[model samples]
Target: MNTFQFPMKMVKRQVYDRIAVQDQISKTELLQEMDITSSSLNRILDELVREGWISESGQGQSTGGRRPTLYRIDPTHRYILGLEISRVYSVLGLYDLQMNTIASYRWFMDEHMTPERLVDYVEERIDWMLNDYQLTWSQIIGIGIGAVGPLDREKGIILNPVYFPANGWKNVAICQMLNERTGLMAVLENGANTALIGEHWAVRDENMQHMLFVNVGAGIRSAMMSGGQLVRGAVDREGSIGQMIIQTDGERLHDQGNYGALEAFASVQALEQQVRQRMKLGMDIWEAAEDLRPEQVHFDTLITGLNQGNIFLQELFARSAGYMGIGLANIIHILLPEKVILGGALINANPSYYEQAIAVARKKVGYDDSYQPIFSKGVLQERAVAVGAAVMILQQMEL
Candidate 1:
């Protein structure tokens, strides 16, 4: 193959990507974004149309005389892999360039699911998915992983995520391992950041300039977007947002642990602990379910109790939501974002919990007299991280 052939091919892909993101683009827009001469760009566009990678989609409004033809990518012509890895479970999905979910699979994490086992599962699933879709390796854009942090995103490592079920997860080069197995390029990012990106894509038309995404579950995952760009840190410590000290004399995780961090108070694990401790101290959660062991006090059960009008659970969850609100207020005070999106199965399971968190946050922010931020539930919910992982591929500079 000619060395120039690769660069030319990449340029064509770049052309297709521009069209893909915009849904439709005209010659003028292409000319403005790309440095190529008009003739070269026309040639590329014509070649793309001939190759069936892109198509002429109607026409744009007339500028001076005749209208310009618009171009769009053939959405089905390519596929991307989106993966979200967390302490509880992982999601893998096949996505079109248009962000459609062609296929998806999920599995819960356990003590036995080490890095090697995870790769084994992913390799096998990708093989099956490709065969089922009747697609080949060459048609794939690449794999994107949205996972727990702190991560070494540049080096493609999962670093040290807290509360991981299995051992041997530290310093795992999962991106390289997946790339070696599937022979596709891979990009890794903090799950929270990916979820925020996914939310960005979901509301791209709105062009939200400032927003916060917080997933309140086993852990508190968070990411911020400001001025139409994600607020990234020098280190990909997404969970660090959870580690912010909320209580000066709160829970101590370890000797050096944060004294009442947001996660310490707002997370599902904390809720579960509180419930079990209360139950042990003669607080009856349910009359019939007296056998509810320490391990059995899950978010679902708590939500179920709330639905049944359990006052004890109502007060307990409300307190948790209040803490969550404090976390939101702290971030909102600094970023003063236009929107705050709350997600995670536990938070979404109860409408009252969502309301209370928003209420507490707004009350503390005290923006009612001035500029108040909007608060809403996460648009993508649990799938945000996984779908956002795929979106990250679209944003990959190399691609």
Candidate 2:
């Protein structure tokens, strides 16, 4: 791991990861679960303790012989920086080894912001946060960015992101640029993947090996975790659930020429367009959205109108929820995940949409009593992407 340059075998790393997740474990438990000799386990544990990654907590009651010494992960030994970039706003957080946010900041993202300007903004914020928290550069393990995609992860570049307001963003080497600017290791990942990672770690559900995370915003996307590992298909496009075809003769077609795609119906951009069209047809949309111009219609404005008893917006949102239900049902039937987590501003603003979508999805799934995946809102909500990005660094560190 970049944070710790200790030479260790794969088995030792695996044992260390287990202890990190479990909080505290005994040598007896490690011996039984790790399938390694006592001498080897002791040597690994000793090396980790000497390296300040693990520490003795207390004694554990033995099943038969002498008491066993318990070990716990040292949470303050290192830190990580997580950054989440979105069209409307961006967030930065500093996290310790135990995944605690020591400091955080959020700022608006102007449509005219450039890549160089963003890097400069981030560098300034990082310095301020470090100073406020009394931390040094040596304490920071690395930086992780949860960015909007499509991305070239291996090359650390953001490749033609959709809905990005700034120009000249094509193939921007975000990670490499940040690494050079801050002199720290950096990694880049899509919003969906990072959000899933954050939720998985936050829940800490050891039994939930199979789960699905859906992000509904300006666009729709999803990520899947199966058998305790992320499912990244060829080209890392395995979970583009938004592109799933729901109808053959669907009128809505995406830029990729796909008809009846999920995003075309359920995304915030689509909702805004639909609202604008209704306004142009002499509909009294302005009665509910009195101050908003037809061209200035946004998802939040629609939600406000819905709250003001606007029937048109109510129906429009319901229809959007139904479309989301169909898409989610298709995902459940194929993946059979243990749970489906929904996130993003659209879902958060109108909770009724999530309820209606789940009701419709349950009906479509039929009477399959063997496995029923739980549907719920993301626990981390808006912070999921940034926190997940930081957790990715910890995972890479094998903590």
Candidate 3:
């Protein structure tokens, strides 16, 4: 929308990003941050307003004659579609420019939610939302996908990830499929990294130059950001955190073949298996809820058992929490981040698990009034990846 010749595209985007991140910013702040002349900034601001991306919010107190105009991203002019496709479930949200959700849908993954079926579901959801809002497709910018890894981000494809409920998940070009269906560009990113982006966006003013986000679910996923950029390994192995060796000869392993791993003892699957083994030994905690199969024993039942004061569950969860702490401690010693965010189904379902893990981590690190990173539960909860993917879509925008 910006047809200017003097102000470059990159510089214009830089200005837009600053305004979009902040709740509100003044003209003076923009001039100081951009280091550009008043005339150039004025031109860029006008273009963004005309493009319906940003607008003058209000007046800022002035040092001189007239008050300076404040700027903020326009909330309703444009929209972005963000999707989080994970092994456990998937979410779709339509967000405005300010990352506010307009309409959203979520579904648990089952044996039938294949890649093609997922695309169809996304298309139907988007159409339903557009009709409800009375907005046309032209107002929608593009799509952003935060999916489980290992992903070929360069190719916008979902690479092979284990333990998915459905078959035919290997090497799916999900980004392209969405683009073809919606007629908008699509960007692919690791769900964990997208969640990190989402958390960082929420805490952009906290001065956390080094931050780590770890998601614990059926598997462990992790992403780090340092100096405002994501820390990426050569391969897209966000789930590799699950494979971190917690013990050399502990004798347990994931079905995916990681021996003596933290996930073997701490993952939801591992906890379920442990609970089943205990039940076989005549443990009497099942009256808290329906007696489910080992494969069906998920966080819902576990949380119910925990609430019923099941002693066996308390001790078992304590051990799993301890393993989680050791894994986090190892990462902390290596990364030395300013903040560590813990999220996912397990942490979200059980508050005690989170508290215990953090306590163990602090003790393992020798808590002596030293510089320890602040550990937090992700405030965005399950929506982190989807909202983060939307933020990434905004970041990839061009003038």
Candidate 4:
């Protein structure tokens, strides 16, 4: 018989070149896109089908007669791993080729995230998760990590983050390290970008193009997406909005040499500091939030109090939402994103936060839909960063 020594790289390219254009396409259309003859394209499609990466999903509607078969990528043919590393904990997520989460692990880092220890811990967890799912290492597309910034994505090392207790993030090449340990390609990205990706994935409307995703937790940032891809600068530092000063006269900052930023005014630590100051004035938030569990101290109690008609807590959240609006208004005036999604711990606890934030923004930016983007809460909520991380891995692998 016959043996066609297929150039694997070209075949891979041809397969993805078709997949990259749309969710599905016809063999004739793909042949035109590839600038190849029908017979050659048919041969490539046959090879892809035999390899189980592409599938024939029946015929398209006939314009007159003789309908053509529609082909599409098999989403289950590959998978990607995503990791969201925070100060106190981490979450590992998995995504299939269609950019859907198959499974996840919410892990508490505790005191064990030391630079030396974290690598092995993460590796073990990845292996265990794959084993549990009965998936092989070869099926993994890649790994994507989203962590607190300012991160060195090129070096794959986390620098000094505001929340964690560390001398400084050491020379930790997380991607390279993970690749060495697990034998898979890995990529690293900022946590805010992951949040943006999560918001992007949740959009049901394809026409709404531009978006600014704000990750409002212990720190604040805005990740921008334009024309369906992240808008990174020439150096890739596009969305580090935490350092944009909103206050004229604020207190001194850490030894990091930054001051009077939105992070200072609106971070979780700032809210905690306010609570401590209120405590000095004999305002017992503990008694006010008496029904709250210890595990739910991270602003759920405040949200509860607000929901239960506690005027004091309502005022606090309202004020925070107001400040958030102030920041977002600035973003709207500049970027004019079609939508803005609010994520992180504090904001997601109450749906009212979006209302309050929009209320404040309306006063500042106005309510005209003609020039304004739709405002909404992040659909992925707290899992956004983790989910984005997983998706990032998949995207990098072009799965």
Instruction: Give each model a TM-score.
Output: 0.88, 0.90, 0.92, 0.83
Give the RMSD in angstroms, all C-alphas superposed, for model 1.
3.3
> What does the lDDT come to for candidate 4?
0.71
Q: What digit string (tens of lDDT, one per residue) describes model 3 on residues 314-357?
A: 88888999999999999888888888999887888788899999
Candidate ordering by TM-score (highest first): 3, 2, 1, 4
Q: What CA root-mean-square deviation does each model show from the true structure? A: 3.3, 3.2, 2.6, 4.4
Ten residues in a row with the worst lDDT in model 3?
Answer: 288-297
Better of 2 and 3 by TM-score: 3
Q: Which has the higher TM-score value, candidate number 1 or candidate number 2? A: 2
lDDT leader: 3
Model 4: per-residue lDDT, tens digit, 2-118?
234445445565666456447778876776666667776777788778888788888888878789899888888888887887664678878887667788777655544675566
Better of 1 and 2 by lDDT: 1
- How many pairs of residues in model 4 come into backbone collision? 0
Clashing pairs in 1: none
- In the range 1-399, model 1's lDDT, one tens digit per residue, is 699788887887788777877978999998899877888788889888887778888999998989999988888777899998888789999998788898899997878989999999998888889999999988889999998888889899988777777888899998999999989999998888899999988998897999989888778888999898988877777777678898888885433358888887788777877787788888777774588776666667777778888788888888988988888898888888888888886687788889999999889987567888888876787789999999989776343
Off by over 4 Å in 1: 1-18, 25-37, 58-68, 253-256, 397-399
* lDDT, candidate 2, at 171: 85
lDDT of 2 by residue, 301-379 (tens): 8788888877877898899899999999998999999888998767887878889988888888867777788887877
